[model samples]
Target: MSRSFIIDGSIIYTNYSQIIGQSKFEELLREFVDILKEKQSPLLNALNAFKVNSDYDVHRFTEYLHLLTMRNIKEIGNIIYYVNPKDLERFIEAFYTFWRSKHRFMVRNEKYAEDYNRRASIEYTVTMIGDQFKATIKNLYRELMMNVSNTFPTVMRQLPSGAQVMFLIQEPNGEKYRKNEWVTKIPTVWGAIFDPPAIFYTKSNKRRGILPVVEKDILSEIALDPNEWYRFAIYVGDLLMYNFVHVEYLAHGAGLANLFELATPKDLESREPDGILIFGLPADKIPGYNEKWRNGVIFKEEDGYTGVIPAFDENDYFGYMKKTTLTIHNLIKIDRGKLPIHGSMARITLKSGKSVVAMFVGDSGAGKSETLDALNRLEEVAQIDTIIDDMGSLDIIDGHVVAFGTETGAFVRLDDLPPGFAYSTMDRSIFMNPDQINARVIVPFNNYNEVITPTHIDFFLYANNYTEVHNDEERIVFFKNPNEALKVFSEGKRMSKGTTSETGLTNSYFANPFGAIQRKEEHHRIAEHFIKKMFETGVKIGEIRTMLGVQGYEKEGTMLAARALLKVIEQI
Candidate 1:
């Protein structure tokens, strides 16, 4: 073929322009016809082997594909539509599944990385002179539109100021989507493609600064096509965070935006954000920022809010976006004399009309969420209202420690839950990497009002997922002293169950590496003040050994912990 593209799994990428003229575009299609004649592709090989249609052989396959556009494919990138393949939908789906399982797409070009994924697929004009071919193409497109619509790869929101923050969701799937209440049962791949397997983070954020240089490299590109992007707003706990996302990472931004409350048009008009993120710049192309930014870094913006730019656009992970937003929110909370916790909080109401707000603090793989999930499953429980699933802040309201949630949704691990947990909520979940390690499911657990509103804390416990609970009494234990409680929480200890790159015993400062690690001394003072206040105010503090990290106790330990919690609640 005169025109070439690097076939990366399901993607056909090329740095050079494919559109030369009508004649050239037709020639390219002719080349594809030749390639199809050999029945080289697995889908074609199987089709021929089965002899699905004896009337037409591989050489006569050109009739199936109508020449799309006679222009260069560079404007929006290359795409292939299956059209109305009828029963072949499964076979075609299998074709894509086979390629996706093989390897991730590689963009091969050493320079000029395309600042986009999820290449836009549009309706082809079918400029060929032949009426038969044109009619076939038109009918296929009509049939295609009836089933799906054009959706972007990145989830984007362009601000009125033209600034944007876009979240490039990693390996999006059609199993579920995030809508109002994470609407369920819609498995439409309207705007997503099968991305390569996601890898564990080799690098994590480790640096912070007072003020960072405002970047323009990405801004310049967005200026070239200002109308292309979409827009969004967020309230991270109590702080307003505005984002202007460039169009390059469109379609998938909703997954990221759903983590927080979507600001109303009224909210956008009345308030200024405490933090702002301008996304879409390629990390490799930008200059003067710290080299460690490639690793991950957060800095104060000139406008007084925390600023975060994705470290790398190429082969990036959603963690960079998720954590950066959390870091900024946590930092603001820290500055405001509030305590940000890397934990989970739930208000559990027993069948006897007794309710208690239980707060579990620990790092990843610590069973903070698993124990709460277990409590929800108990028959004696009325309902467990989850105030926070991962990150939240502690504040003194009316002389009592009150917990506020950070995220509107829950990004949960599939392997940790009971067998049917994820599948049962398939209607309102975004399933990611379900076939791989650290497979996760993101679901909207509650609404914005519930997240931002404060809930009083009754039982403050450090999750001890690594420890073995030999008996019911051992499942939950009080620290006996405020200092002892402080000492335990300060250590931030947990046993790694492979949620991250760590193994064995691990300790993070106050179980939060996002913000406190950057301002340890200040956070230490805050933690001490809060710990003593909780003790003084009659809030019971202790540890619950869910043993989620125990080699064989993953499921059983959480149940034991839940039952013990129930017993404790009943006695009170």
Candidate 2:
């Protein structure tokens, strides 16, 4: 009546007649009995080898046999046609393979042993202690002193609109630091932590940059320290719209504070943070840092707020820091049912004094910023004001679609810009890993009001940076149908320009993963409503192929795209 089995130390019972028909159940039982009589000794040996302590493992084996029998009966003639000595041996081997694959501890242990041996084989030898050695030791001591100074509590006492930020250091031997989950998973490397890299960009010379890690993994990897001393409070955005980030860990707090506007401790204590970011412990401390899912960055949407946790070191701080802000903004925007587009937006005033606000939606390295920056420099476009450089939101305001910027500063790629542009903003810019190909700079180029204020959008365009256009007419294609326009906008298609790990051509829905991807239904509803309204209001919709992403055609493609954009503007 009832069949019982053990799996992973747990007992599971099933009613054979209820699960499989009575006839099939009897047929399987008969087959299993015959097999036991013939191969009982070998099967028992195999079970013992697998450490099967209970009867459930046997039942599980019978279940597998039943399924296999059923499959053979349906495919071939009858149960007698398939169940034999040869097939039974094959089945046993297949089951062993499946079990071994699932139980991978043995494999992992061997891998760990290999890695330990490899690391142990490396040699580090010291020669005679000459003048050079003495000087090297002295330089090391000086560098240690500099790190000590830089490791002190960094406080930003004042921020615009009464926001402040502070980074308090945690004691090395504190109970909170030692007892955290992340600490337990990963061993702490104090020397590596104390002497972190000065730059955060990737070292790759290729045009495509490092791929961004998933946000959820980054958040889940964090293990918060109980001590409040390791915490920091910062205010970001502006008074009209702003959010507070109460983060744990000095490096993450410092990285974020440097990237965005800071807020005061008092403001954070009084106001609920729009998002919370926790950097639990360093990546080196995590046990399985090399695993695919454990890249140490994660984001989660909670009740009334969003949260982000990133496991990043000093060398990758710039990229992760930017991601933290973008992730938070995206979560908030999606929660509020607003569309957050990954692109650059600007308000351009033509020579005729007609001002039009446009949003160039695309992934990174899609020429969104470059095209906007080039247009800003053109004499025909006399005045150009940036709303947001990286990420922003689109919403309906006063019955008209309006665009709002998210940050006061722009985190721009150095390789994309013309020579001398980075130097011009050096006074206000924070350059990161300048020697690397995908180096970055954060500069306060746009006003806070310009970033936060809602500007009426007159044009919506996709920056087609990688597509090949045969003629000038093909460079820009206007969408006459709203469905066609929505399709293009939703597809978010573009060629990879090495800003991320993706190669060749890739596409994202709405060219936005943060906001649009999170709330698909809401994004669709908002986008459809906006697109229909734009058509009715005479707002232009089209694509501009900059060809900046293509190799060997970067300059020529950009020029051609720019000229085409200029022509489109002239008609407007």
Candidate 3:
């Protein structure tokens, strides 16, 4: 016996060997088909597979399986359909295509690429930032021009000494004219001119408007009349000086703003000028008597038994300081090669020799002021002319040192000074003006005080934080300690052959701190290379060379400093 059954419209059965007959099988097949047709009452071609009971049903099942496999293949193809990229393809093509929907892969044209980038918003933003800075300068200038026009009257009343009064028109040179012909011979004044106090009248011709003064010839005609000449100079000088004050203020404010706008505090602090002029209180006036007190300091008492102890209470007071408290003026060394202008703290080379120039620096405080005051006092006591005092101008002429102060003044000893001198005298050294009647009186104190430190040359060394760098590139040396740097530069003896050329032996520095010169020969070679580079770059030019020897033009001094600074590697 054989049993046959159909499941899921497919044939399944076991063949029997004994009872098999064609007529019987045919009959059974007809019966199964009738049952399947009854199960599906409605006639449907798609349903015909269900009514079938033959080998043909197997062929139908095979077709269905093939269709199901095709569906799965389509699903997989949809999941990971991607175009293959060529090995020669550039990243830019992929980048542009990723960013821009309209982009297509092709060889990019240089001109088109440039044009596209130029039109980008990022480029526009950069261009706008630059324009903004320029505009700020213009606005500042306009404001200054208006202010000067309105405040001319006030400025005339308070003109500073050393102020120059200029005129718009200069008098023409001509043959000598009689003093009495003043009205007729006087040049017509136009633009702006300073008014002379004196009429420049001859002793022989004493009439008003009768004698007129010509430029530079004002004193020649009246050699014996210096008093009158000086009076006339001041009157005219005042008028001319006022004219440019507003313009200069505007330019300075704009430049300074631009410099500080983007600078961090560290950047500003790190900016080392050619020299620094310290004007505030002396270092000894601070709570602590130590090198650490140079910047500024605070005092705090440790936990103790209730109130204060006698001598021990003094020891409890200490100082804490920040580097910013120090008042510093950056020196713009001006000499023959440099020009002078407003905002310039000139670093003038003394008449002293080059070796001395390397040592003389400007710093005044308890540690330095007292020691220098002693030397200066000795000269005064000995009735020896102390050639220079506060506010001296230095110039080197024909390899000779020349220094003369703005005016004669007294010198004070630091030891006799009251405690807390640093906090007491903030603007004595840098901003004092002789015309202001603000004379610094250095009265001789015969009395001695135990609180003051005794005189010692070593104080000048430790009180000053000196940093030296050798400019192998420019063959120049720089000293940074303000109080003693200039003095050392001015007085330091030439190093002997056996002395090592370290910071202690020679006060020279490479503006670039990271310069590599471990060996003596390497140092020499680097120096030569730097000198050659500087020469090629016009560092030897009159303006650029001012910083080379500590004395040069006043106007171009900062440029000199910046040039030398390009070689510095570290701060001392």
Q: What is the C-alpha RMSD of each candidate to the true structure, in Å?
A: 13.5, 22.4, 39.9
Q: 1 or 3, which is superior by TM-score? A: 1
lDDT of 2 by residue, 385-412 (tens): 8877888877787777777776777778
TM-score of 2: 0.58
Cα RMSD for predicted model 3: 39.9
Query: How many clashes show up in model 2?
Result: 22
The candidate scoring highest on TM-score is: 1
| Candidate 2 global Cα RMSD | 22.4
lDDT of 3 at 227: 13
Residue-level lDDT of model 3, residues 1-572, one tens digit each, is 11111111011122221112224323433444344356652222322333355322533332332232233323333443321212102221222122222101111101111244553533343234323322332332223233323222334222111101121211212322223232112221121111111011101100011011111211112111111100000001001000011121111111111111111112222231111111122334322234433322222112100011111111111100001101000011121221111101112122231111111222222122332322223211222222222222223334322332221222322223333442343322211111111122222112112101121110111121222223434423433323233233223222211111122223222210111111223433433433333333322111112221122322232233333322221121
Worst 10 residues of 3 by lDDT: 233-242
Indicate which candidate wins on lDDT. 1
478-569: candidate 1 lDDT, tens digit per residue: 98888899888888889977766577998877888878877788998999999889988989899999999888998899989999999998
Give residue 70's lDDT in candidate 3 (0 to 100).
31
Candidate 2 or 1, higher TM-score: 1
Model 3, global lDDT: 0.22
Per-residue lDDT of 65 in model 2: 42
Residue runs of model 2 more than 4 Å from their true location after superposition: 1-255, 280-293, 296-317
